[model samples]
Every structure is written in structure tokens, then in C-alpha cells.
Target: MPRDRRPVWAELLGTLDEKFVANAVVFEHATPCAGLLLRGEPLRTETGALDRELVLRALAHGLARAPELRRRLRPAPFGLTTPAWVPDDDIDLEAHVRFHVGVVATDGPELPVLLAGRLNPPLDPRRPLWNTVVAELDDGRVAIAWRIQHAVGDGLYGMRLLDALTEADDAGAAGDAGVAGGAGAAGDAAADGPGSRAAAPSTSGASTSGASTSGASTTGTSATGTSATGTSRSTPTVPPLEPGPHRPPRSGAELLRVAWLAWWRRQEGPRGAWHEYWRKPFLRRLRRWGGRLVRPVRNHVLVVRGLTESLVPQRRYAFATHDLPPVARRARELGGSVHDLTVALALVALDQVLPDPAGPRLGVPISRRAARGDRRNHVRMTVVGIPPGTTLAEAVPLVHAAVATAVEAIEPSPSRVAEPGEPSRPAATILTTAGLAHASPAPTIPALGPTKSATNSPTLSPGHSAPGSPAPGQPGSASPTRDAPPHPAAPHPAAPHPAPDAPTRRRGYASFVPWRPRARSLGPALVGSAVLWPVLDPRDDLAVFGSSYADTFSLAVVGSRHVDVDAVQRAFAELVLGTADDVVAAVALPAPPGAGPGVRHDPGDQPGRRPDRQPHHQGGGTP
Candidate 1:
């Protein structure tokens, strides 16, 4: 039915998290925008001014096919209902597609800063929740960067939108065909295709121009000799926008249905009341395997631990390389995928800087591709404890096993209905006596404090902590310096202590965190073997996000102005790449065809012919 009610999922997410943090600092500017970097020829007029007409035409054409792009969110009166998607009666393309005059160094270290600066700002709520920044790089290549709100779509949908925009000729053609149908279709076509004429800037009584610039906009008409009023002699023939009727409000029943559906999709539940009763039994088994699920913190790295409620504006640092072939080859040899290898590499790198190796509870984002709803955050998490100073060979297996177990556990199981006599829901606990009903709450159990790992103990030296043991002075520690001063370079603590009476120890599994707390701590950081994959046009690809995070890691690293970008990159490369090499070396190769007495030389081996076997993939198959 095209979901006429409203974006229930988006409303839920928006309300759940009002803030996002990273690297122990709150990310004040986390507005959840899916960004893209596209490389293509600069679309400029011969006059050297931005070809507003052509650009608008092509963009409009693309938007025509994607109705979601044309829709603007209208929140219900006083937040009484979910935000509904309505057609933007006033569509302004120029305001959305802006031209940047600065020289963009696409491959340099400055690229991350450029992207963060552009994305940190929130998308205009009144308009279509998207913007495109077209900047000309120093090398004369054009970089088209897009920032679309996550509330509107997800990674896959964002990719589809970009795919539509890039196919200029096809988009324009489709847009032209749509225009002839009706005013509504015409508006969609005008949003993306070059075949349609562009609406002049509302403020100016100027005519659109057919002439394209040789380069992007740096100087206005003052440099290009074009009229400031935009009155050009060659305006292309295209249909003008005809105002459409105001969209009718959704029915009360429809609105109620949406609200009900959102409630049904919630993670914690009435059925989950069983967890409250079954928690003790589950904990007993978890304790036997692994102790309390304490999240591992990177104590070695520097951090600015701001107050949990305070707003801490944070920035991101991104560096990518075109060299992944060697690492990929090595991963296959170690009986692991590239993802497994990446996790091992990250742990190895972190261990180098950490005083002790028993990693904090590291959360790996696992993608829930099979999720039913079309919500953006369709992902689960897997927490893995990286052992201290573990070799790449050993770590890969550990990573693989941990991820497999987490993914399997998170999978949705068939719902079990309670018997007629049993209380399946909390509401069912009511008992009627003497015409009065009394609610009987479930029996509350005494919560246990955090359990100290049995193997957790002290170490003789900072780097010499024994595997599976806790750091000095930590619970269950036997070190003499348990009361020694904290290390001067120790990383900032992540958060405040949990409530005194709360269960200090709990089993680790795929569990949902409260929206506010999770949002407050979510920010950008190097996580889960983050790999940089270059696109067909490396110059155009603004960012390359590793899909592994959707399914394995959400490592938010907080970086500051004082952070050394080059130095950090070098250390990271040394750890991840070095680990890859270690894995490849550890793999044993088949002893070279058993050097036998009967030496048989074929014609191919004798002269210019090819050898029987050339150096191909190692580890027996392609990574």
C-alpha cells in the first residue's frame, strides 16, 4: 500500500537516541548520514560557471524513479504521531546540489576532514533529507559527494540512489518519459534528468541556460561573462511544475496500526518476561564457560573521557590503501576469510600499544540481512574477548569461532506460546478475588556483583601479563603493586560504574542496549579489521565503508587536533599487515613434489614453454 501512514521505524530510532558518542567522548554532531564519493567529469558550462541547468536536469531525472528521494518528512502536530513522508511542494535543486571551489586532495590525509566537515551538519528537515557537494579535485577530476539521512534509507538503498544518479543518459530518458504522463511525473523527471528544463532560482526572474561550463563554479558571472540574473538566450524546452493537491492525512485507524506495529517490532517484550525468570539458570551455565560479560576497554590508547551527559563534539580520521591483495592471499592460507584475518590483525595491533592483552569486551557488528523490516539499523552485535598477545594463526580461529557463535545465537528463533494455565504475559499475572483484581509481580532475586575471572591476576611487568589473567590490582589479583598509582599513559575510562545493587556480573550475548546509552557512546573508530576497498574510480569514491561492521564491529575512535595522523596510520599498518604476513608464513606447503631419483623433465620445462604450475593462490584457494 506504499506505507501511507508514516515512517514508524524512523520515528522509533530518532526518539530512542538523541545523541551518539565515540572514543569515550560524545559525538555532538552524529546526525546519521550515509555519504558517498563519486568521481566523474566536471559538469560545467563553457562560461566556466556551474551548469545549473544540466546538473539539475540529470539529478531531477534520477529522483523521478526514486520517489523516496522526492519525499520530505513532516512530523505530526506536536509529535502526536510518527513523521509521515509527503511530497515536497517546493522542490529546490540548487540548494541541495552545491559546488565547492576548494581543491580536494582525494587521496591525501585531508580527505577525511573534508568529509566529516560536510557531514557533521544536520540535513535540512524541511527539504528532501539529502545534499550533494560537488568539488573539483586538484587533479582536475570531479568528486560528487552525497549525504543522505539514514532515516530515509540504509546502505543498500543509498547505493541504489547513487547508481541511479550516475547513469546520466538513462536517468534523463526515463525522466523525459515520466514528464509526459502528468505534473507529478514531471516534477520527478525534473529532479533527475537532463532531457527536462530546470526551474529557475525562485528569487531570480532569469531564464535557464543550455551552455555548460568548462569547469566547476569558482567565479560567478563576474568571471564567466554570464548574466547575473541567469537570463540566458538558450533555455531548453521542458514542462514547468504544476502544483499538486495537499496530501490527505492518514486515518486514525491507520495511525494506530502503525503505532501498534512499531510496538510489536520492539526487541524487549512481554514474551521476554521469561528472561527475568530464566536469567539465573542462563547465568549459571554462562559462568561455567566464561565469566561476567564485562566489555573490554582499550586502556592503552589515549582518550578524553567526558561526562556521560555532557556533549562532546568529536571528529573522524580515515586512511585507506589500495594494497589488499597480499593480505587477501594470506587469509586464505590460514583457513580464514579476509574478515577473520582483519579481526586478528586489529587485536595484534592493539596489543602492541596495550599494557596487557586480555582485551576489553570488543563488540563486533553483525549484519541482520534477513531482517523483515526496512529499518536502517538492521544489524546485531557479537562481543569477543581477544586474548593477550595471541598469534595471528591462533587469533584467526578464535575470531571465526566467536563470530559464528554470536551470529547463530542472535538469529530469531520460533516464538513459543505459553499454555492456557501459564502466564505468558505480565498482564496475565492478575488474580481476581471478591470482585477485585490484584497484580502479582514476579519474585525478585538478589543480584550478584561482578565476578572476578579465576585466571585474572597480576603480572611481573607491563608487557608480561600472562594470558587469561587480569591486570595488576584488578579483582582476584595477587600482585604486590595492587595499590600502585595508575599508569600515566593509560587510556581514559569509558563510563561511570553501574548502580551498586545492579548485577555486576552478567552473561555476554546478543542483547540490546538502551537507546540513550548506546547513542551517547557511538562514534567513528577503527573497528573489526576495517579494510579500505578502492572503487573503479578511486578518485570518485569519497568513502569505502567495511560491511563487516554491519555484522561485526562498531569501533568508535575519538581523535583530536593533537592526534598524530601519520604516526597512527603507520602503527596501524604495521600491526594489521604484519599479522597477515605472519599467517601466510605459518601455513605449511606441500613438500615440493617429493624430490625423487627419477627426474622427469617435460618439454614445457625444457625450453620456452610454460611450467606445469606457476605461483598462484597460496593456502590452497583464493581468499
Candidate 2:
């Protein structure tokens, strides 16, 4: 195989790195698939009906720009070598694209409910590992949910793909008009009679549209883009598929040669190949043993002690939005970045809602891509520890310094090959932040009109302070403002220790696990120091994903079934907006089953209550 024979873009798409391979392995063993969910205005025809044609056209344009979507993983024969990226000749647009009509009661839980349903199921490995669903809301809005396997790309890559699917600017107005007109023409043909319309495109054995088989009620037409009464309509012509370079299966001899070359490249250095090969293995063994020896004590002191774990296998999602300007200004006033503020606020809010003796350790992911266009998952994880009862102001500087040091200390290509049933480092929660506003242009859909804030939650505007909230530098502004009484600082009762005869839980090995058990007994016999031991717990209590696009900063919290995601979301919004009674009332809802009573603060509660003990800022370690 000649590397230079392929186009640079195609080569990038086909090149599988250790991190990418690990992601694939993790997906197979533990984690479900991950992707993006975006909401916007629904594209409508002149007659005000959902315009399916325009949606397909926009998707076609996106597919052309992101050729990675048309490729699938081809595993090596009998696990002889790593999987190779190969082109899928049968690119069925109808099978991959679907529509849902008027199923949402409101923008709040319905969309996430739909998203959760879509996310739970794994994408078919045989086909291109991506799917898009267009959802029409009762409020006349549209939510586009696109899910891709983790092996395809990371969060940043997903954002880039989203950019490709959308128009650059108002320039798309004419294109939207053209597509809508074509759809109207098709509708007119359908009106004449079913026989007058163009023939429906041929489909493979797979269902043409997911929504068609979902048994959900749809308005005006069926999910297949035909009338509910079964009249056929001419489907819009989508752009030709532009898949990556096709690589045929290699022979056994070829696989061996490729594997040999890969090993040789690994041995290339100042030292001779023989010395480097032996030395590397020896060092890895030494480190592994050293880690195992010290892991229990380290985890006990830094992770397990003073922490509360409320995680279960089930996940629930809650979203909140903040106006960017005020949050940015506040962060700058506190001598930190928006990311620092985000971490700080999360700590404050989590402590209030799920009060523990100690603040949770946060696992932050840092991207290590060499360039903007790098398609591989070049990323590393760094952990940061916040002291118990630290106020927002105190937490910000600590978080800032910790994140900076962690980023500086990250080694290149630190991702190790994932092994089955391997335990990951214990972190109570994970925080992921992406500045989409600073990335590529925001997705623009003329038919959806200007992109607006997806949430109806109240936001603080520029030069505006939260209600009854002082300026950042003023007194009473150091801690997050609260409208509900703070929950008692006492930690929730620790989970009951596993029964003596109960099987020890095996922590899942995956690139991502939403929630997991918190503590495991390593036994005093193994450490020869303490009776109680601490080991890596693969599950986390919570994961907060924050992204900024244009003027809005959105935070989505995914938590375990026992956790009250909605309460966390509300607390986050309150902290960000600094508003009081009305905001809380508007956002508050009954807590989900298994959740504790919602915590509300009194208006008289002080905002600058300092911690009684000295704050401890734990340095970053492997996540």
C-alpha cells in the first residue's frame, strides 16, 4: 500500500491512530455511541407544510463536505491487525435520514426524551456509522439529531461536521428558496394523483426511514415523505455520494508487512532498534507495577474520602443556556477564563444540590490536535480536585491553575491501547468544554430563519447584572447567588457496603462511562497498609458538557438515574443568571423518582460564606 497514492483528506480519514482504535474497542465493550443534537426552526414550504426535500438537500451538502461519514470500519481478518477504514458502496440516504412530526409537547423534556431514545441504540457497524433524524416540534421548531460512532471522530470533529451541514450565511436564502420550490412542485404533482408523481427511489433491505417504523403519529404525511393516505411524492434528488478512498482487503503477507512496518516505526529513535524495543517494554512494566502499588493510597486520600457517589447505569440529560457576555465579563473580573468559571460554578452548584464533605474530582479532556483539520482523536484527559466547601470565587483561581498545569504536563499521544475489563482512573465527574463560537462559522439555515437560543431560560445580557446581584468586584458577589435555602453541608449517607458474598463489580472499560460505582475494596492484604482499599471505579456520577456558539453558552448535564439532572440544570442556570424567585419558579418542576427533595435557597442567604477549613487544591493526574 502506497501512502502517497491517496489524497491528503482521504489519507487523514483512513489513518487510524491508537486513540481512535481505543475508542472503537471501548465502544464495543462498554460505552454506547456518542454524537450531536441540534435544535432550530423547521424548514417549511410556501404552503406551510414540512419541506422534507430541503432537509435532504442540506444533508446531501453536508455529506459531500464530510466524506468521513460515508466510510465504515473494516476489521482485520481474525484480529491479525488493526481495523482499516473502507468505503461503503451502498450509501442509502433514505435509510440514514428520517423525519418525526409534532411529537413534542414543549421544547423542554420532549427533545431530550427523543435524543435519549436515539442515543441508546448502537449504530449499525456494517453501514456508514452515522444517522440523521429531522424532528418537527409542535411549536413549529425543528430539532436535528445526528449521531456518529465514537470511532468516526471526537466532539470537535462532530462540531466540524455540523458546520458542514449548515449554510455559511444568508447566502443560503436563495438555495433554501430553490429547494422549497422544488418540494412545492413535488407536492403539486402529488395533488394531481399518486400516479402523476415521480417513482419512489429504490431502497435496500433496510427500512427507508426510522420514523416510519417507530409507530409515532405524524402530521400531513408519513415519515417516508408521502401523504398519510399513501399518495407517493417525488423525493428530492440528493447529491452524489463522495466517499473516501476504497481500500481492498489485504493478503496475509501484506498484513504481516504492514504490522512489521508499524513496529519498526515505533522503534525509531536515537537508540538502536533492539535497545529501544526492550527498554520501552521494561519501562511500561515498571510504570504499571508502580501505579498498581500506589493507586489504593492515592485514590483513598485524593478521590474516595469525603466524596458522595449517586451514580447508576441509567442516564438522564438536562440543558441550560447562559448569555455569553455577562458570564465572560464575570470570569475576567475573577482573573480566570470562562472555562475556569464553568468549573467553579459546577462545583458550587453540585455541592449545593448533592452536598458532600469534599468537592468532586473533575476529569477534563484536553485536545492535542496538531492542526485545526486533524481528523484523529488527538486528546488527553487531566484530573483536577476541588477542596470541600470551596466557594465559587475561591474555586475559580484553583481550577484555572490546575487546568493550566495539567495541559502543560500532558504528554504527546498518551492514549494507551484499551484492554478488555481494564479499570480506569476514578473521577467523580467529567467536564468537557468546547468554544464553538471560536471554531468554524455557526450553522445557518435560512429556512429555519436566524439561529436563536435553543432554550427559553432567562439569560443575563451585556452590561446587565443579575437581579439583586452585585457586580463581580463588589461585596456579596464572591459566591454564587442562591434563591433556595442551601442544603445542609452534611454528606448523604454512604451507599451500603456490598454483601460479603456478593460478586465484586467489574468496572467497565470505555472511553466514556456516564455513571459508575464510586468505591471498591482493594483489601488490606494487597496494600499491606490499610484494611480498606481504593481502586479505580469506571463509573462517574455526572458529566457536564458545555459549548458556546454565537452569544449563548449552553450547558448539558448527563447524570445517573438516581441523580436529579433537572435540579442541577436549574441550579446552574440560577448561578449563571444570578436571578431569584421568578427564574426558579419558571424552571422548577417536580423531581424525578428516586431523587431527593429539591433544594431552594432563601433570599436572605449570604453569598460570601467562606469555608471554615483551608481549601485543598489537588494537582492534576491521569484521568
Please name the candidate that would achieve the greatest TM-score relative to the true structure.
2
TM-score of each: 0.47, 0.55
- Give candidate 2 regions above 4 Å deviation: 1-42, 115-121, 173-312, 370-375, 411-538, 580-623
TM-score of 2: 0.55
Q: How many residue pairs clash (N, CA or C atoms closer than 3 angstroms) in each of the candidate models, in the order given?
A: 43, 9
Q: Which lDDT tens digits does candidate 2 get at residues 1-623?
A: 54535422112122233222332222322221222222222345666565676677656645554556777666554444445555564676766766653444332344443443232223455687776556554433344556555456554444344444443322344334544343111111001111221112112111100000111211123455553422234355655454445543345455445555656775756476778547546766465445435533553553244221112133454444444456666666655555566666766665665565434455544444433324344344445555556666666666555554444344223464645753232122222233211111111110111111110101111122233322211111111321111211222222232335633221111111110001000100000000000011236555554444333344555554455555555555455556423223322222223545432211112232111000111010110
- Candidate 1: tens digits of C-alpha lDDT, residues 527-605: 1111111111101101112221111111111122232222323333344444323222222112234435432222122
- How far is 447's C-alpha from truth in model 1 (Å)? 45
State, as a TM-score between 0 and 1, how close model 1 is to the true structure: 0.47
Pairs in steric clash, model 2: 483-601, 484-600, 484-601, 484-602, 485-600, 485-601, 485-602, 516-539, 516-540
What local lDDT does model 2 show for residue 107?
A: 27
